[model samples]
Target: MAADLVRRLAAEALGTAMLVATVVGSGIMADRLTDDVALALLGNTVPTGAILFVLITILGPVSGAHFNPAVTLVSALQRALPWRAAGLYVVAQVLGGIAGTIVAHLMFDVPALALGAQPRTGMTQWLSESVATFGLLLTILIAARSRPQAVPALVGSYIVAAYWFTASTSFANPAVTLARALTPTFSGIRPDDVPLFIVAQLSGALLAAGFCRWFLAPEQAT
Candidate 1:
């Protein structure tokens, strides 16, 4: 059990690191390649979504591919994962995500620990985060229960759509949010705004969990 847990933790860390690297790296590349904001966003969004599908597909068997703290929290609440393991998962994810930011910075020849200046805050932003996370959790819970084989594709697709639809570009993961704050690149969020974004994300996750608990319940035989 201990050995298995260790492997799982390693998978989570590595997976999250790769995920964040894609996000930050793609954002940097996009910004440099284009002056058009929409085209740059497209560049960032496609790589992120593609990497997510690839990561989740390859890593899901090992650690359930929960690169997000919000996802881990919901899984623990649902008893799909133990609380202690969940805590470790969050730690690994956060550390890995931070490492990813550093990797992206090194790749781009930027300051490794620069604090983000991009201000991603305000009521609409918070609401977008809440909605984004809510949709993410709900999609995961429903798809995992019903069509487990399609989770990678479903999650990737949802994120792709969410990016275009949400006001905040759907930063639904706490670990990702925290990591992005360390980069002053196109994908970064202000350090000051991380806390509330996380709060909104967690709130959305819990709401999804609660709704699923009741909504996905097995129908009682009459």
Candidate 2:
């Protein structure tokens, strides 16, 4: 049991690091394609989603693949994971994200960007973030509850879509956004904008967690 727990923690750290690496690495590529934001984004989206899908499947059994703090909190609130595990997982994810961002910055020879903060509170931007984050959380809960077989594709596709559709570019993962700030690449967020975006994401996640109670129902959740 102890060995399994250790493995799970390590998996969480490694998986999160990979996720951040994808974001930062892609950002570096996108920066080279700067004049064309759309193309740059497209370039980044494919690998980001693809890697996320594979990582989730690879690490899901071991760490439950809660690469985002919001995901971990939501899962724990639903009793899908223990509270202690949730906190530890969040810490690992955050650290991994930071490490990944740093490595990507050095590897790509780009100055680190500000923390990847969520976009600000313009009506459209805020709505975009709220919707994006809500969609991500909703997708996870639904996949976990009903379509277990389809989770890999569903989660990946949802994130890919969110990146294009949302103004904040679907920074659904707070840890990821924070890490991205450390690198001035395609995926980095500005430190100044981090707090607001985080607030929005956390709020969105809380709403989603509440929605889960209704959507999944008491017996269904367990």
Candidate 3:
């Protein structure tokens, strides 16, 4: 890899690490502070959203702030990111996500890797994941085109809303879903259930990408 590409990959890894830390850490904090599941969820939702906006704002210029594999995949398909670089980005993201989860667990004095016991399965959960991921990708696609500066807040807002509306709590990023499976926290998903969530997320991301291609940027005739 070239020096520039190496730097960008490092940025992706570091940013994704921080993003996962923010999410898992916040979920742990919320679970500790509240008996009410609603209040705990609210606590989890707010910080995760806030952190996401901040991460994107700070990292956007460096590596396009693509902390999600689904987003990266779509970007590659759209020609925004080259396929080779996208593959590198996915590797970094997955590694960073696992490291971040371990860090969060350590910080909270929890086990390093827990295969989440809670079941996040079934068709309804899968559907919810699809919807959540679709909305998230669509939000990024539209905002990035019309108001580039607003992408951070727009994405944060959409995710915050999705957390409540979707049964899967909007695990829109495959990296995140995989990392969350290692935690026995409020946000954790069972390891066995990760595949379905990933499949749903990918499907949704592709659908959004296709829609954006058709409507937002129509193909030119040969």
Candidate 4:
């Protein structure tokens, strides 16, 4: 059991670290190559999607590859995971996100931009986060419960799509959002804005949990 727990936690941390690194690293590198944020964002999207697909497959057996609190929370609510394990997963994810951001800050040169940080506080930004998070949770539930084998590719595609569709660039992970705040480099959120974004994300996650309970009721009962 102890060994299993260690493996789970390690998977969670590694998955989350890869997630943040994929977004921040790719974005920063792209920005250095091209001045266009749009081009850079597009460039990041490909690798982000590819990485998520591979990571989910690689880590799913150990930790379910839930690199976000929202994903873990919703999964727990859906009975896909126990609350205890979900709690540990969330902690691991958050810590991984922070560590990944710190590494990105150290590795990349400082830019005029706020390190590809997430937006906070504005009504539009909050709304974007809410929508993005809802979509993320919804995707997880749908993918995991219905098409379990397809989860890796489906989730990766969904996240990449959400990035372009959502105003807040679909940063649906609170841990990742917080980690971004710590970096002043490519993808950091402002420290002042971190709390509000996290609040919005948590709220969105809770709402997704409730909705998933109702929508996936048949599956949950099984």
Find the candidate with the highest TM-score and give its number.
1
- Who is ahead in lDDT, 2 or 4? 2
Estimate the lDDT of model 3. Answer: 0.91
The stretch of ten residues in a row with the least summed lDDT in candidate 1 is 213-222
What would the C-alpha RMSD of candidate 1 be, to one decimal place?
1.2
Give lDDT tens digits, candidate 3, residues 157-221.
99999999998889999999888989988888889999999999999999999988777754333
The residue-by-residue lDDT of candidate 2 on 38-114, one tens digit each, is 88888888888999899988988888888899888888887878998888889998998888887777777765544
Error of 4 at 93 (Å): 1.1
What would the per-residue lDDT of candidate 4 be over residues 116-135, giving only the tens digit for each residue?
A: 44445598888888888888
Top candidate by lDDT: 1
Select the stronger candidate by TM-score from 3 and 4: 3
Model 1 compared with the native: what TM-score? Answer: 0.98
- Inter-residue clash pairs, candidate 4: 115-185, 115-186, 115-187, 115-188, 116-186, 116-187, 117-187, 117-188, 117-189
Which stretches in model 4 have alpha-carbon errors above 4 Å? 109-119, 218-222
Best first by lDDT, ranked: 1, 3, 2, 4
For each candidate, the alpha-carbon lDDT, in order, equals 0.95, 0.81, 0.91, 0.80
TM-score, candidate 4, is 0.89
